[model samples]
Target: MSFGDLLHQAGGMGRFQFIHVTLLAVPILMMASHNLLQNFTAATPEHHCQIHDRDNDTRRLNVTEQPGPTTELLRAFLPLDATQRPANCLRFTAAQWRFLNPNATGANATRADVEPCLDGWSYDRSEFASTIITQWDLVCDFRRFQQMAQSIYMAGVLLGGVVFGGLSDKYGRRAPLIWSYMQMAVAGSCAAFSPNFISYCIFRFLTGMALSGIILNGVCLTVEWIPTNVRTIIGTMNGYCYSVGQLILVGVAYAIRDWRWLQLAVSLPFFIFFLYSWWFAESARWQILTGKPGDAVQELRRVARINGKKEEVDKLTLEMLKCTMQREMASVKSTYSVIDLVRTPTIRRITCCISLVWFSTSFSYYGLAMDLQNFGVNIYLIQVIFGAVDIPAKFISVLVMSYFGRRVTQAGSLILGGLAILANIFVPLELQTLRTSMAVLGKGCLSASFNCTFLYTGELYPTVISKVSDDEQKEKILLQTTDIEKTKPTG
Candidate 1:
């Protein structure tokens, strides 16, 4: 009998499968939190150069005791940019008290000599009580550091996919996934308590690496254990969990305005995930293919017992597992590598197309998702809208794909998303509602594109090349680095 028959004999999709899938899917909810954590954790608040101590005293007094005259007093100490807001990087060399006169126009204020913020900056803390930006003073000249931190984190993610993908194939999914849980918990917590920007980035990099490992191995474990008929449904459900997580981040970030506390809140749950992860059985298919039929038999029997098929599984043995998976093991003996992806013309073309799709989808997806502050709305409200759109978008995508097919679904979503993004360029900036709507539309379509890409890419690759190709596919996440510079907000 084939392995599928063996799985049926062991009570496929029974109680054990339910629990296994539930536990595995729970961790996925937080994956979105980590992926989009920077949106809240690094939010730049309104800031301006610090005024001299004497002028600062006057400003403070004006804020607390006398309000009207302090408006003009601020003009004496700070220069207004084109937007007529205080310039973020410059301060008057000495207070131009003349500008405090009510008749002094903005033109007269512009003539005052200014210098770089030599002392420091003062941030408006109405929205965020704390963030990496405020904590580290990553404003003006240091603003690029914010994007640099995210790039480093994405680099770690790229490396983790390469490292853990092969390691899971060699070692086993459960082990790497278990280790990844602990790593995420530890690294993310460490990032929360990081004493400096460099340390925070380092910890976040490790957290990103662990995130990749968790995702890669978690999917492998879930797919390998479950019956094939239900795989698509289960996969879609897991994707939904990530969408739910985006909404969860909005609530948590709103409640805890401090970045460190927010980071800790999202991270500590992984520790619970790590603790229970030890209960998971390794993939029986992996065990059999790797020449451990004895262990595979044991695991299958354990699953059978849990699924209430003890009588049927009592007859199971190592010989039966080896006999059933003999062909699969034989196939495993032949190795594949990156070179094989392009060794043939057809495969080469497929690889290139899949890579491009992955790159573009991720590029546009993160570019919009990461720049929530630029949307010119309440960040919490915009985040909620962004998260909410994904639910409908993914649901529609699944229906379209089921009815129309993968190619049509994938291509249509990308085209629609691109048109949405392009349409924004011609719209007037003053039309805030229209701009926000268009952005949300583009983001949702891109999210749908991402959903289609995953299933489509998996179907396109042959089994022999699939594993290697999946790893290579993840490597293309390096394309995310290019977006760091592209998405930076302009003055």
Candidate 2:
């Protein structure tokens, strides 16, 4: 019998599976918080150039018994921009006291000399008590620094996926995952207390690296333990957990209002997750394929006991494991590398297609999700709406996949999502309602596309190529070994 039968004999999908999946899924809620954290933490606020001390004195001396409005006073020191709002980056070199007159127009305002904000800038903290933007004065000339910080964090994410994915294959899923949790806790908390922008970016980059490790290893562990029949449903549930996390970020951000505190709030929970992660059993399949059948048998027996199959698993031993996994072991004897992913024409084609799909979905998804403030609505409300849309989007995706099939669902979602985003370009900027609606639709479709891609790609690639690569070679050899066994004669 195959390993699936062994799992069936050990009380499949019982108490142990329930608790294991639940515990593993909990950290995922926080994953969304980290991914979308910048929405609140880096939010830009209304600001203007600081008035000079001399300008302040001049205003005091020039005040009449009945002072003019604040807007009128600002008009003397700041020039109006194209939008008729006071300029944020420039101010009149010398106060134009004439503009203080009630009927004064800005017809000659362009003739007045202007200078850059030499003193600094003043931020309106009505919405955010503080953010990266206000904390470091990342406005006017320095605004691009904010985007640069995010780029650094994303670079860490890209490298982490490659580094951790290979590390898990070599060292096993549990170790990398445990280390990831601790790293996230430390790095994320350190970022909250960062002394400056550079230190903050450094900590955020490390935190981004840990994020990939947690997600990659977590998914691997969850999928490897459960029955194959339930994988799709369980995977979708995990995706939903991420969606719920987005909503959680809104509430926490609204309540906290300060970037440092909000960053700390999302990070500290991983310490608890790290503590409990040690209790997780390593994947028995990984253990056996790695030539640790004895450990695999022990872990299996433990699982059986927890699932209330202690009596049935009494006969479960190394000998039984060796016999059942004989073919799997044989297949792994031949060494393979990551090149094997594209070694064959069919596999190569599949890899290229899926890569493009993943890239497009991610590019579109983050493009929309990260620009919440541009929607011109309350950031908190818009964030909630974005997160909530994922729920229905994912649910409907599952139903469609179950009926119309994975390929159709995957293609349809991407097309519809791209169309929605494209449609917004022609719409007038004045139509905020239409623009926001289109963006929401696009974001939801992309979310569904992500959900479908995860399950679809897993099904497309064989387990050997997916699971057994080492850091040096970066390939999945264990599943390759199993596939070899399937081809053997049944004498």
Candidate 3:
């Protein structure tokens, strides 16, 4: 019933406001990794990769053997030519040649190999089921289904980005953002129940519609409320929150192997989040600039109160409002339309370049994460450790992003991520310890890109259109990923 207080992304918010907005970074971090493709498709098994830990700063990694030496045993399960090297790599037995865990042989054996597939002892291992397409055994159509799930949700995100961003300008940031939570609740719950390819996809697409707002609007909402000097600190800490979510996800996955339950665990929280809508207030700066001068004044009063200011509400004047709006408008070159994105050379260049970065970052980032689930590592531990890597990146971001610059900081993150990914191709899999260390590093490296993307996106977009959620488009994306399971497949 009440607009809590007016807030702005870059400047004009007080001390208390800064902390509140900083918390929004958590969700932005979560959404970046919460996709079905990421949670389900990107998961790895406890067996696949050889755990070569190049433990120290040295090149030599300690080697360890285990019962499920999947990297050594599951090579033939995949179609990778590199994995099938005659001399070097650990090789997998064919499905027909699968044997039981050799560790059960005796008490004296320190390390024994465990073979997963037993013809007579078949079990429902979803991660293994996915290998049908990954290994080329299932044909192109099944693979297409996987890709389609990824693509559709992303497309919905694209639409939501524009629509929700614009809506922030046209109506207000809070309304659409809060509304998105409602959609997320419904879409996510439904997505959990999706059975067939079509039905699963539909629910995921709807989830995307809700997702569309989470990043753009949530961050925008926080930016509106926090102070500038500490913004990056709060923002990066938000990145840390996502890793926490990842850890949370591991617990959820352990309890509920089914895709539906996983979706609910993540989605249902938003339903609780929706209640905060009543506690939120429209951005006073937005209100004032968009011609709602009286309401803006009221909001500014509330903020002044929260920050412990002694100033009376009646003391707020049109002069202060004018000064704030003037500051915001100074940066605007001209109003941009969707058409202007292509029509204007600079806007087009920036848009297209960022878009490519977005697409590439998303594809590779999600791709690698999904790919890891198939890598034969301990899924729970891998997920937890993977989430753990973000800690350093978040710390590094806080230190360098402000001192250097967003462009430089972001470009470096991308470069590092790309190099790490490419480096994975050359590492010998028989050197299990080294391989795991490298893979973990690669995951950590790529996560930096995600952090940079959200931070960069905030700096680039104009305030008004930045937080709108494109409902229809976002929904489309959510549907595609509904059928995905957290257990990734290995060939």
Best candidate, TM-score: 2
Tell me the tens digit of each residue's lDDT in model 1 across 1-491.
56676778788999999999999999999998999999999999988887766555555556324323355566767888899867889988977777767787887877788999998887888799999999989999999999999999988888888888878878988999999999999999999999999999999999988998998888778877788788778878888898999999999999999999999999999999999999999988778767788888888999999999979786788777777767666766766677867876667887899888888899898899999999899999999999999999999999999999989999999999999999999999999899999999999998898888776766666655433365455322112100011001100
Instruction: State residue 296's C-alpha deviation in candidate 2, in Å.
Output: 0.5
For candidate 3, lDDT tens digit of each residue in 1-491? 01222233212455557545654554554464356334553232222323232233121121123223233333223122333322122223322112224432223221334332222111225443332122222222233566666677766666676677777668877788788878777877776666555776677777776787765566656655555555566666677776676666667667766555566677777777777654676766457546677777776777677666644445566665556456444324334356644554544575687777777777776676665545557666777777788788667765667688778877887788777778868877676566667667766766776676666654554332221246633211111110111111100
- The alpha-carbon deviation from the true structure for residue 94 of candidate 2, after best TM-score superposition, in angstroms, is 2.1
Ranking by TM-score: 2, 1, 3
User: How well does candidate 3 match the true structure in TM-score terms?
Assistant: 0.68
| Reference-based TM-score of each model | 0.92, 0.93, 0.68
Per-model CA lDDT versus the true structure: 0.83, 0.84, 0.55
Global Cα lDDT for candidate 1: 0.83
Error of 1 at 112 (Å): 0.9
Ten-residue stretch with the least lDDT total in model 1? 482-491
Candidate 3: regions farther than 4 A off: 1-19, 22-33, 36-38, 41-122, 125-144, 323-334, 339-349, 402-404, 456-491
